[model samples]
Target: MELLYNNSTNYFPIYYVKGKVINANIQTYGGSEKMTYGIGLGYYNEKGIFRGTGYNRVDLNSTMNVTPVNRLNVDLRLNASLSNRDRTSGDGTLQSASPVETVPGDPQELSSLLPGEGSVAWNAVLDALKGTKEKNRGVRLRTNFRLGYEPIDGLNISTSLAADYSIDRRNYFQPSYMSDDDYSKSVGETGINLMVLNENLVSYNRTFKEEHMVNFVAGFSYQYDQTEYNGGSAQNAPSDKIYYAPAGMPDLGIQESNGTKETIALKHYQSDMQEKTLLSYFARLEYGFRDKYLVSFSLRRDGSSTFGEDNRWGTFPSVAAGWTFSEESFVKDNLSWLSFGKIRASWGRSGMHFSQNYLALGIMNVGATPYRGQATIEPEWVRGLYNHDLSWEETDQYDFGLDLDLFNHRLGITLDYYYRYTDKLLTTIWLPGIHNGYSSQWRNAGAISNEGIEVMIKYDIFNREDLYWKISVNGARNWNRFEKSYDGKDFGGNIIGKPLNGIYALKTDGFINEQDEMKVFYNQQGVSNYLSNFYKGAFYKPGDYKFVDVNGDGTIGSGDAVYCGSALPIVSGGIVNEFRWKNFDLNMLMAYSLGRHIVNNLSKAVLTNGKYALMTDLNAISFWEKPGDHPDYPKLESDRMNSMWSYVDRDVEKVNYLKLKTLTVGYSFPKKWSRKAGIDELRVFVSGENLFTWTNYSGLDPETVDITSGFDLMSNYPLARKYTLGLTLKF
Candidate 1:
């Protein structure tokens, strides 16, 4: 006997002001002979975007199995969760006292004679939900247990234990009449995190009767983690209905304004704790014959506590092989319509411990000075500078593969080639703040190398029973460099053989027309020494910008930077298509990226000459006025200070795009109307995510990176184009 069941539910909504979402899931299971059970439930709720963004979650899980004899077996699992989240911390209060162009540059314009104070773009999401409010509450627990033994037949042995716990609490309130400003505040936080895991296992399998086959496994693992944090904050609160006690506000007296007397700052709080551990040992081996030969081997040995105990352990290894030339009989006697093929190779080693300071190998921190003058806070070993060879961070990988199934199986292909090779490489080094006042030091020098190539293809192109079509394509290219660096120069601008997130600038050669304005004021070495040399003389002229001294050293700072591109993506891809008739179905996905480079920085903050150029909203692209008319920007300067080679090579660009990313249409409900509504299955779908894009990168998104200067694009957040309608039911 056998039985199984599953259920799902979802409701999604979007249209601003706390868009909504609700999801549900359920599972059920069945078994035969000596007990087996399962249960799962999940629910999620979301109402986000403005007004204290949202989240609500709940989950419960259970599993059980028992055999009790005849080679023993027992397993148990449980998980529980509860959550409530909402965090929005103010910022965004709509300000504009000038430069306003609230739409209208064409299409039967309506004039306002432009002056200012007319902006409205959802007033920055309703002034960021008026005056802050944050909340977070969470509780979670997890459990697992397992035991197994095979006193005979093929061998098996196991042992496991797992535990997890979580607790979070946060509360914040801002009200100073919601900062129309007079100052009022409150904050509170509580966090607790813990985890534990243990495992032991042994396994063996054999089959020497069908042309040799063997399997083996071994394992041992242990992990532990802990975190605790407590917080408190209070500021000038006399009422907003109290409650933010760090000894009840109001203290450190002295106040009188408008005639001077000031001094009033009292209440504050903080707390923290951390812990970490890890230990591991593992092994694996497998072999096979006549099944067209295959081999595997693996090994692992960890031991961490965030390194430094003289390089706290690490040892990883891997090996693999496969060959199945369609079970070769010379490819089934001369490739008669070949239907299968395989080739494989692999090599590996890995380690990287994320780094979360378990003292980072040395201690003493606390900092903040003043003492003899009363502003206390001490304990400092002068900030980080100990290295017991910090360790952990070793990559090393290689892979080669091929898989194919032609015609007889309706065409399919896959090919891959890879190489990794990481090496010490765990950021932050530089310590030498004039004798180690600590400015870096997180050791593990450098070395990086990544290589890639991948391809996948699938086809059906209409194989019908009632019409069916399918298509798929995949692509990859990748290539990274920087294969050594203990200094070899430049890290934060990423130099040394480039591509560690590349993109260094300075190298423009345009603008500056007016027939080169006397060869740029005679290479600007003078012009009568130009207004005392501001940016190497009289701050440019004749339509501005013209760089590229590139160590030819006619001037152009930072030793004329270089490597101006690549923020990943040296090829990337996707393409999928599917169509079906009968009950209707259609799908399309399409994504692409090539070479990669962006950084329009919102058009150098509104069309060149920097910092919100004429104050705001500009960029109709084409400057430089007259002098044989050419124009491609450069010449519109208002309070110009720009000149990092004038907006990093005129704002990068070329982020080769091609997105469609998703489009789906589906319908299914006809199984005689789902058996008169007793519904065994039902479906309805309409989806569009991103939907369209083809880029020349003027930046608003060529997939805008820059979440804090990862590759510098600036004017972040702007990539939302979605529409979804879905319904699916099964019982």
Candidate 2:
């Protein structure tokens, strides 16, 4: 029997930034006839207001291994975790103010105004934060058990079962003592998820003639998961003292216009649940010859309960091959600096599942229906038609790659090119109103193609006994377009031959000037008639935006709207550098993305329309005020009601940015110093994340785009900049 133990503790204490972490691990190993076991525990705590957020967590894990026979083994593992988090208010209202309200002025002047003692704006925000509170807590538990047997020398078999359970709870409360503009309410939500997975596998590995080797594995898996959520809320509480649901406020009842009075509902509740199951079978084979050539193939068949009976299963297969060029005698003899080189190619097929819970089998929903001019509430099928043959989206991909290592492997580079085509894309088929007024059916009748190239490079600059430095750079470029639609049609703003997230708008030819307002003419139509007929009678004086008539139809209309920009980035990359010298190390990462367009909704919402003119600082803008003022913006007006369509093209702007992702510096004490204190090693580090960003786009941040919707409305919480100083000791 043998025993082993390991432990570590980290502590950081700084003003407005403090954290602590402790971990313990233990293992017991026995001979083949005895059982082995291992256990671990971890605890972490953090508290900081300026740090944007804080959390505390505890984790525990245990594992046991048994070997009852010469060819059989069994292992069991369990893990549990608990965590709680606190976040700062990051909303527009006072109760959720983010970074406080900003006023237009110099930094020095703004600093002179203190909360409560100076400006009213500062005092209001401080009051709101003090009366609002939000909290989130979560718990997770997981367990796995596996049994393995090796009856023969070259063959092995294994079976495993695993289960996971998690629960998350959140509470948000705002007191009546908060500002008058804010609502007084309390809300709580709880979500629970459970999942079970079972798998069985068999593998065989053999080498023949000491030059050729082969390995194969086949597996079958089944997974099932269920999720449920419940929430409760109460609004218009009697006072700050009663913040939870079932708040008492009948004394302050609400009176209706019909001379009736009633108290608000003490508690309102909502709940939802969903379940999914999947079964899959997969196999893989790998072969290598002379340690220089390699080939691999894999296949998987999956069946999901979410799909219709006719299309419930999908097959995926992949094949890859590689050749080591550096292993050739001619190259090895001629170029000693080339340490290693390989070329590889691969082709694969995959499937995707989207947000269609019960689209394949239409659902009967409960809603209010009108019968005999009287509204009656009952259960009925939805208005839209259902498709019983909905299928999974399939994608086929091909890739070619090259890898190189030169100067004794000090420099390494990898390049890859890939093309992917997706067929049977899941989408809705819109139907004319004549059939069922604004109804649509789900179907798999869309196609898209995506291609990209990626390159990665790494080099060791300095390598010595006391100093070492290395740098890594990676970049990628991608292009995607819609290939086909069910009926060769466009939905919403999506168009064929264009990206899925492409924006459509009318082209703008700059603002109209005072001298050209009366002089300009459209096919014998004056400016006044053009504005009156096409612009919904909105007056456009000298400084309004001028649009190009794409159709030359004498008027501006929907037909003039064309593809203006896309939300997909053409290029993105990151650079990382690491340096070590005499027990000290430093690391930095910089990331960049370009060729993506955004609507700049934040600028259009807050910087213009003359709504918050004095309340917030606006972007640098120019307006046409006189005959010769030809500026980018229109004349400043308190109540300008221009057509939203007219500015759709102008609101779009390319977002290109470079950001310093992270910077860290650390130092480790010598072993001798730590050994004297009964410790194996000690390390201290300081790190900063999201230090700065350089961008031409005039929004909150370029990295805030949504992945599924491709929209950045600046409504969510802003990214936070964080700084941490920590020390670790291991024993």
Candidate 3:
């Protein structure tokens, strides 16, 4: 057995709060129960988890909303955090000493005017630490911050700013590194240990709404981020403790010594200063005639930093008209079942920025520029390659909705349907040309449409004998399409049939049936089963799982791939049922999604837990015990690889199932009992999540989906089930 790290430790205080001033002193320590990486910075790379952030600091927040002035609102917020963390570097690299060096950026950009002087060394940092442990000393700080704002309604003006001055040495790890990824352990020490950050954001919000309901807003801001990377490891202690400096002391003068060092990805530290401003003019007008009909029109023009020279500004406008049918003279009192009804419709156009700083303007990457002497890479897109010019991808949507309330508002229902078509899509794909380095330039080469229908219904079930019951259900169905594309224009291919955005791999069929059945089977590549088996001259065998070939070509191939039909239940929604009796209450919320399938991509990994790091704890190996065990899962070395179907052929299934999302049971003590307890009201609740699952999926919970992995159909992160018991009191 190989050991990634074996250790024992104690660390120091990098953070302590003395009144409002928090001081920094770093000392961190720990050993790996399982292999883990040594991060030199506060990395946010989340691997198998939501974010790559290492054990993150627990945050504490409190807010105070105070009315200092009659018409003004003042709000103050304070935040604190306590986190336990440790980081390690490789062994004794500091022995072969290197003198400190300097860089040119400030902690808060406050040093921007001065030629920045920074230091990095094999020994300089080692002297500042105590402990033979391979400690990164980035021990987290207990930080505190305050934000205050005062706002006056009609005047529409407020200033909001945030400061996160951590006593923790400032270093930003790229997002991908701090992820909860399973692979994080193996590559933990791959990046430089660095620190540098004192950032701030301050902004003002101002809006003007007129008597006619015309409203508008405008703003500007700047952001500066700075970092300094110190990749040195320590001495003495252990070989894995790179920052510990082999001698365990900084001033020991162990220079010119030789030792091992685990190389981490030296973070390419670079500072970015972006001065951003948003200029906009907007107006909205609302009019109602005799309170029976209403009309609204609004327009906004915005200029931003992300656009190219010509497309720096985009203008959006919307118009809506509604009719309140119940307000009519003849309809006001005729119907009791229909208390009120409003029919409304609207059309609007919105623009989305591509976000690249120079997306709109042509740019040249100049290398080592002395103006004329600089090497520059020119923009490749020949100007005017397309008939149209640049503009933000535009989405034009039209909506129709009906809002109704019946029987004194006891039964209420709302139905809305919308269709949005987005054109000038700003995305890039490989054009069919090797001349342009295997690709062509970026362009608005296609269009897509998103249309959906939504319905919400609520009813107050009858109440009797001091008990009340209510039920409500809401759901929506949507269809998305790639409306047009240049490639489809010249070919017979169904551009409209572009496969659904993310389809579970092809559904799987059980073991091959009769010999004749095996003959028709095909791999995703469209290779014929008959031809394949004939050449091998094999017949269908029992308990040998099989996959059906959608294409008669008899192979599971890209050619046989088709758009997924009704995936991940196009119709997804939840139902809430509530009942109240005396002083007790019960509520059940059940939600479901059908038509979506999970490829069980991790099947191979899990099946072979015999080899991988995470799967080491699995017990399902050697699945079939004896002759008639007739296990459906195969235990083959080849099956674990690209065999069953490359990452694409899929052994997918229709992930259609219903589940209860949340159920809560609570009890409220009688008012007299609350008074005895000196509380106005008291309640307690018990809740269990993912209490049950009814599905054929063998992997894990069906509710959670992994965002990162897909190419090979591996199982995503397994969602955890939780149970909570809580209490509340009101005075």
Please name the candidate that would achieve the greatest TM-score relative to the true structure.
Answer: 2
Candidate 2 on 1-731: residue-level lDDT in tens?
Answer: 11121111111111124333333333333444558887777777765433325677888888888988788989999999998776544321222323322211111122211332334645554455446666768899999999999999879999999999999877777786563423476777788999999999999999999889899999999998898888766667656766565634332334354666555454566788888888999999999998789999999999887778898899999999999989989999999999999999999999886554666766555356577887565422333455668888999999999999999999999999999999998876766665543356678878999999999999999988799999999999887888888888865556788777777777777776754453334444433344422654554556666766678765566778877677777789999999999999999999998888777654345434323222233445566677667665566665344543235687778788999999999999999999999988889899888899999976667887764344665544345577778777777
All candidates' lDDT scores?
0.69, 0.72, 0.49
Report the lDDT tens digits of candidate 3 across residue range 432-534: 6556442444566678888899999999886676788889999988877668875656122335645335553443454443445555555678755452322
Q: Which is superior by TM-score, 1 or 3?
A: 3
Estimate the TM-score for candidate 1.
0.28
Q: Residue by residue across 551-601, what tens digits does model 1's lDDT show?
A: 664455667767676677778889999998888899999888876775655
Clash number for every model? Answer: 0, 0, 72
Measured by lDDT, the strongest candidate is 2
Report the candidate with higher lDDT, 1 versus 3.
Answer: 1
Better of 1 and 2 by lDDT: 2
| Total colliding residue pairs, candidate 2 | 0
Model 2, residue 683: displacement in angstroms?
A: 1.6
